[model samples]
Target chain A: MRFLHTADWHLGRLFHARSLIEDQAYILDQFVELVRTERPDAVLIAGDVYDRAVPPPEAVALLDDVLARIILDVGVPVVLIAGNHDSAQRLEFGARLMQSQGLHVAGCTSATPACVSLHDAHGEVRLYALPYAEPAVVRDALGAELPTHEAALCAQLDAIRASHPAGVRSVVVGHAFVVGGAVSESERPLSVGGSGAVAAQAFQGFDLVALGHLHRPQTLDGRVHYAGSLLKYSLSECGHDKSVSMIELGADGSVQITPMPLRPLRDLRIVEGALAELIAAAADDARRDDYVYARLTDTGALLDPMAKLRQAYPNALAVERTVLARGGVAGDAARRLREQSTGELFASFFREVADAELDDGQRGALEQVLAGMAAAQRESA
Target chain B: MRFLHTADWHLGRLFHARSLIEDQAYILDQFVELVRTERPDAVLIAGDVYDRAVPPPEAVALLDDVLARIILDVGVPVVLIAGNHDSAQRLEFGARLMQSQGLHVAGCTSATPACVSLHDAHGEVRLYALPYAEPAVVRDALGAELPTHEAALCAQLDAIRASHPAGVRSVVVGHAFVVGGAVSESERPLSVGGSGAVAAQAFQGFDLVALGHLHRPQTLDGRVHYAGSLLKYSLSECGHDKSVSMIELGADGSVQITPMPLRPLRDLRIVEGALAELIAAAADDARRDDYVYARLTDTGALLDPMAKLRQAYPNALAVERTVLARGGVAGDAARRLREQSTGELFASFFREVADAELDDGQRGALEQVLAGMAAAQRESA
Candidate 1:
């Protein structure tokens, strides 16, 4: 059984406050062509079908068009699972009815098997889909006391394994942050602290595990793979080689994995140089049409550097100045600013101003004053 | 042939910055029950399916559930058209596929016959749907220079008429502001001044013309009718008797119209009285759960009137004070203040302050100073 694994379409995403609907549409058209040519028996989208819980109308229309073309026009079955960015109920609205037409979408996580059985030269291969859920949701759904991502996922997977028929090849699809997987800036934090990560060993029973959530493609082992996001959503993701996973499951529970590249309409690139040299280079660069994030190394400020750069590269999103940070002093200061708490920063400022360390009583008084001010502000607001 | 005609659903509407999704869902569920009990030959939804071009996820989900229940579960045919609030292409997505499932949605006005033919015990009844379109859209679709709503609609109706076979009764559905139809504050203007009002005579030929866009239920003639909206959308529409239209089209082109009241989840009401009396009456009133707009006739300034009212009427949306206007002095002044332009007000103020009217040069200098201050503030901001 052959299937294509992809996720994080992020339809209706806004990049630098500009709508990326047209760009998404263009790339998805290419995705349709890819599906047609590949002729996968089923396509698995792990999660994040929409950028927000409530997508724009054009995004909804685009999804409707793509799904219809793939399911009705190409006659291919699709299995999808909702991610954190999707409203599960909204995505699952017509899932049961859509099943008859070979569009299987799982918008909620449960202990019960939400699997689609497909046949090829192999007798049968069951693909179990688990949509993204918070630890609390998973615990409630399973009627278990699992409190962490690993425990919740393990409980759900154990139930799935118990229900699995013996000697049938199986695949597991999930939207989770797996341990040892790399992440990009655009990927939202899955949990409040460091508790969202799950272990690869928990998913060991499945022949192949298609994962999502991390925006950079990664692999825990030969059997577990991250499909990653198709588009470069942030400048920090400029280095990511976005791709989808192609899985071929054999009759004897053996699997083969291949990476399929989804070329973006306009590549995202970061360029650094003196403003003049950067502009000169951009004029002759083949990738000038790409979305550019330029970092200028000029010590003195350049007047309207962005406008000047746009003359050669019209898609320059932003220009960064390295004037104060060339020797790393400003960079260190920024790092310290991010790492320190407000109370500690204030204490340091007080010491600098007074040229003496604050006594315990003074520090306590200062903290009380700050707390009172905060309380008053909250009350008035 | 019997059919239930409804329009101006305004799903995803916001009232006083609060989402109306829950209210809309409650009403639409009742609508589903109405469809089941009535068992009309077909249901005709005239237009304004959504409040905005892009609705939230819950609104989309609600519509999906309602349509599926009516078309798939209850096994009824529904014919709908796009309103000014909808994006035609978005609403039209998957329309052809939905047609096979007894759901007909027309998203754009066209010269082509956009009709769904349904058969009853007597004969075939053609429902010609013309979605809302601007003059430009209509002209482009028809390849004509028609410049007014009446002409554009006449052309569309002519196309439908030319496609109509003899000896068969037909109904026309449209989303336009007809002349002489009552309107409410919430209904958006369909076009620039004057041109939006289409003459009622233009729709004379159809056995029944279902109209939308006017929030007040009205009839230009016995044949042309506005179903109005399902709920009281604006405070100005407090007196509107909101209802859906039930039309029975005879085989010989005779039609009977009936108004069907849709029970709202919560009624909208306006209460005007002295503060003490209104509060006293609220204790005995059973409709305190209604959304209330209160006008208190207290002569002196009242303290926290809205907060006090909420003790009895928690859903009170607005409060107006009649303190200063009790004897009509403040009311007249407020009316004049609203009616006068800035220049006129400035002139009057100058006359009062200087004991004389200003000449053109002085007025020009004042205007320039105000303009300069505005420019400086904008620049600083």
Candidate 2:
């Protein structure tokens, strides 16, 4: 059996206040082309089809168009689940109705995880879809005391395991923060702390564990895999080699996994240099249309540096002054200010502005004023 | 062939700033029960499935639940279209996939109208669904110069007629304001003027024209019918008899229409009397829980009447002073003031306040001040 695994489309996402709909549409067109060429038995989307609980209309249309092309035009079955970013109820609107069309969606957690069985020469392979659910939701659905994501996921997997026939090849698709998985700035935190992280071992029994939420395509323990996001959603993800996974399962349950790289219409990149030098280099740059985040090392103030950069790199999204970053001049100044006492800092400021040190009499007067202010504050307290 | 025809659900609608979701859910439960009992061949929801283009998540869930129950549980097919209030693209999200499950949706106007041919004992009855579309959309889709609702409807009907097989009974579902159809305040005006009203003759060829947009349940020329909204959306619709249409189509193209009344959880009503009397009467009122719009006849001031009314009628939504209404003392006073010149009105007010008419000398001083003010106003203009 052969299928493609992908996730984190993040349709309707906005990067630095600019809509990525056009970029997403372009990449999705390529994805559709890939599906047409490959003719995979089924396309498995782990989760995070949308960027928010309530996405804009265009996002809905884009998903509709893409799904129509894949399911109706290409005649391939699609198995999708809802992520933390989707409104499960909204995503599951036509789940039952669409089942006949081979579009299976598990938007909300249920007592029994949604399972689709496909057949090949080896017989049947069951694909279990577990949509992202909070611990509370899992607890309510399963009537279990799941205090953490791991507990919730464990309960869900247990349900799937109990339903599966022994000795049959099976796959589980999920959205979670797996332990030791690389993180990206664009991924929303599943929980406030480490409690959201689940050990990859929880998915050990499955033939293949397809995952989402961590926006870096990678393999965990050589069994669980993440397909990553379709595009670079944040500057921190500029280095991510975005791709989908093509899995070939043999009759004896041997698995062969291949990474299928997705080429984005405009690549995201971080360019670092002095503003003038960056602009000069951009004039000769071939990828001028790439989404750029500029990190400037220039010490002095530059007038409308972003505007200047846009002249050569029109898609420059954001700018950060390296002087203000950690280990730079502004950081040093802030650290020094944190160590200084109020009196010493005031005296130093006076010296700088007045071009002279404070006299003893002036210092004494300042001390008296400070003492009075402290006394007044204590009284109020 | 028999089917239930309904429209203008306006799910997620808020009445007097309060969500009507609970009320809607209760009524829809009864609607589903009716469908279960009747076991209609198909259910036709003409349009306006949502109150807004982007509905709240709960509304989406409610629609999902309702459709699931109707299609999956009750085993009835449903044909729904998009009205002006819906975002066509968003509403059309799983349309193609859902079609096989007998959930036909026409969210956007296309060159070909969405038609579902249902088989009955007599033969095939073609139901053509024409979702609400602006004149521009119709023009673009049909490549015709449709400048008004009538022209657009004509073009759409023409397309349906061209494609529809002759000698077959048909029903055309639409969302539009038909000429001479009684309208209530709850209905949004389709256009600025009369251009939005289509002629009843435009739907003459069809066996029955199931329509929406008009919140009142009425028949135009005994052929075009509106199912009315599920609930009274505005105060002006308090008198509307809300219901869905149950149509019986015969092989001879004969039609029998029946209004299946829907009982709301909380009825909307206008109660009139003095503030104290209304409150007193509420003590013995059997339906105090109903949504009340109180019209107080008391001329004097009352303290927080709405708050007080809620003690007896917990669902009192609004209060109005009948004294301020037309033909009351305030209205008579306003009329008298409109007739009086500024000088005459001011003199009368001086007499009422000071217990003395303006003396000639006082009048002369007032006239001079008024003249100076008028001159300044003229200069500014």
Candidate 3:
């Protein structure tokens, strides 16, 4: 069955405090055109559909528009999941209602391993939405010791496989930082907190794995791949070969993946030169530019660098005149308070932060809390 | 000409700090069903689409589901605007993109009104999305100095007529406080800083003015009306008749607005009775038994009023005992400081609030500001 695979749209992102809503729309517009052209049997968005857990209203509008086009306009079933960046509660809010519109949204880690089987010419192709899972969530869901990311993912995948036996032609969609895949510079460092891991071989059983979270669209062992974000949201993703992965899974469990091209709103070019030269270079570079970020190598101070850059690039995301001077402070008091107790820490930090005073009662309460912590540590030891 | 009038949805609203998202959906479910049954030419969500400018993700998802149903599933043209409680920049974020899907969203209070003419069997019906306009916005738009709401609205209406020459079937969907519309208890006091006077005559020329801001579905002088909020977001709106207005414009300059009853999530009730009596009375009043609030008037604080009430009303918005009193020391102090200079008032208020001292430099700066204010008052005198 022909199906398009893409994920991590991350709409409503603000790169360097400049809103990327218009830029994001530019990319989404291209995506809609692709859906209209390709006419895939079903579209799979792995995860992290929004840049933030709580996206602005504009973000909502964008996602709504795109989903409508794909599901309603094109009359294709679209299966989606909530990624680490997404608020599961929000993405899954109207799942019961959206299901009637040929759109399947899986936000709950529990309704996971959710398989959507669509009838093609040959037979049924099951699509599983395994959202980014936490170890704790897995442990709670299965009552097993899924201590690491790999274990949690393995547990969930096992559950997903149980739903469909080995004969079922299935594709697993996920948002995880898997091992063996080169971490993209733009991808936020994969969290190893309460419920995350990046163990490779988690999706060993699936015919194809559609991934997100990592902005770089690439294949791991030529099977799993990160579709990446729709647009470049940060300078860290400076050289990201940003694109969506278009994967086609056959009824016989055969797979074909293609790199879909991206259309950027503006060239996010970084130039290094002297302050004046950098500004001039940016001015020369600002040919139908949508957004720009520049760094200067001037040793001396260039007064009002941003204002100067704005004279050339109206929407310069950043203009920092590099200070090549030696970094040496006479006495950095901050280094001393690092090991202080909650009360001493507060008093010392506040002494610098605001010269704000804390009365004895408040200080005493903090001291008691520290004492309690020490006692608990000792007891545990 | 035909159009469905709906307003005061108040997504992400809190009825005394309790979320009303579910109620919003419950009410909107019926709204969509009505739209399908009615099959109106277009739908107009006047304003207050969301309760807060930064709505919670739940509200966003709820709105997405509802809008998707209206614009995509039902395949009806939808016109929307940002209300007083919403941030225009946020609401209009992806409006330009949504226009492709036959959704016209106007979120700006600019010089010219956003008039989209619909070609129907009745020749043409011009739908103007004139959102909630404050005096400053109205004055800026019309190039006129204004105080009364009526004068400001008159100026804008005159401009619309001058441009569009309101046909017999021109409709204006607005979010504003008209003079005579009955304000529900839950509806926020519309005129806060200024006494707005949106006289009935200002709505002349337009066959139907779909109004919002006042969350009570009613006709003002048999012409203007408020399409009340979907579900009760505040206790004041309890027992208020909430519904969406359906308008049908004839070939002549006459119109008929039908108040389509929106099935509220649950009948909001505020009962004052003995704690024992209310709980004993809960078995019968449970019919779409969800989201409730109560005030108990027992002689003294009964043991765990919440627990007892929960037995009958599991989803109680709030259960407050009239016997439990709140301290009013701050209120009394605020009353006394009403006549003080701004600086003095702030300083004194902060001193009491923080219970802290101001250094010499801070105090002197504050005193100098207060003295400057005193001098200004003297000069004006």
Which CAPRI tier for candidate 1?
acceptable
lDDT, each prediction: 0.81, 0.87, 0.72
In model 3, which runs have C-alpha deviations exceeding 4 angstroms? A1-4, A26-43, A57-80, A89-124, A133-152, A165-168, A189-195, A263-265, A268-381, B1-9, B15-46, B60-82, B87-174, B184-197, B202-210, B227-381
- Give the best candidate by TM-score: 2
> For candidate 2, what is the DockQ-based docking class?
medium
Write down the TM-score for model 2.
0.83
Going through the candidates in the order shown, the clash numbers are 0, 0, 6
lDDT of 2 by residue, A1-381 (tens): 998999999999999999999999999999999999999999999888999876877999899989989999999999999987887878898888788898999998899888899999988899999999878789999998998889999999988888789989998989999999999888876763233899998987899888888899998887788989888998879888899889898887777889999888899999999998998898789899999999999999899998998998999998988777656677888878965656778899999999999998988788657655543432222
Can you list the residue pairs that collide in candidate 1?
A: none
TM-score of chain A, predicted model 1, versus the true chain A, to 2 decimals: 0.87
Error at A264, model 2, angstroms: 1.3
Model 1 lDDT, residue A192, Cα: 40
Best by lDDT: 2
Chain A TM-score across all models, in listed order: 0.87, 0.86, 0.81
Write one digit per residue (lDDT tens) for candidate 3, span A79-111: 899877777766775465556567788876883
> Against the true two-chain complex, what DockQ does each candidate achieve?
0.30, 0.61, 0.15
TM-score of each: 0.80, 0.83, 0.62
Per-residue alpha-carbon lDDT of candidate 3 for residues B12-47, written as tens digits (9 for 90 to 100) = 877766777777787789989999999998988888
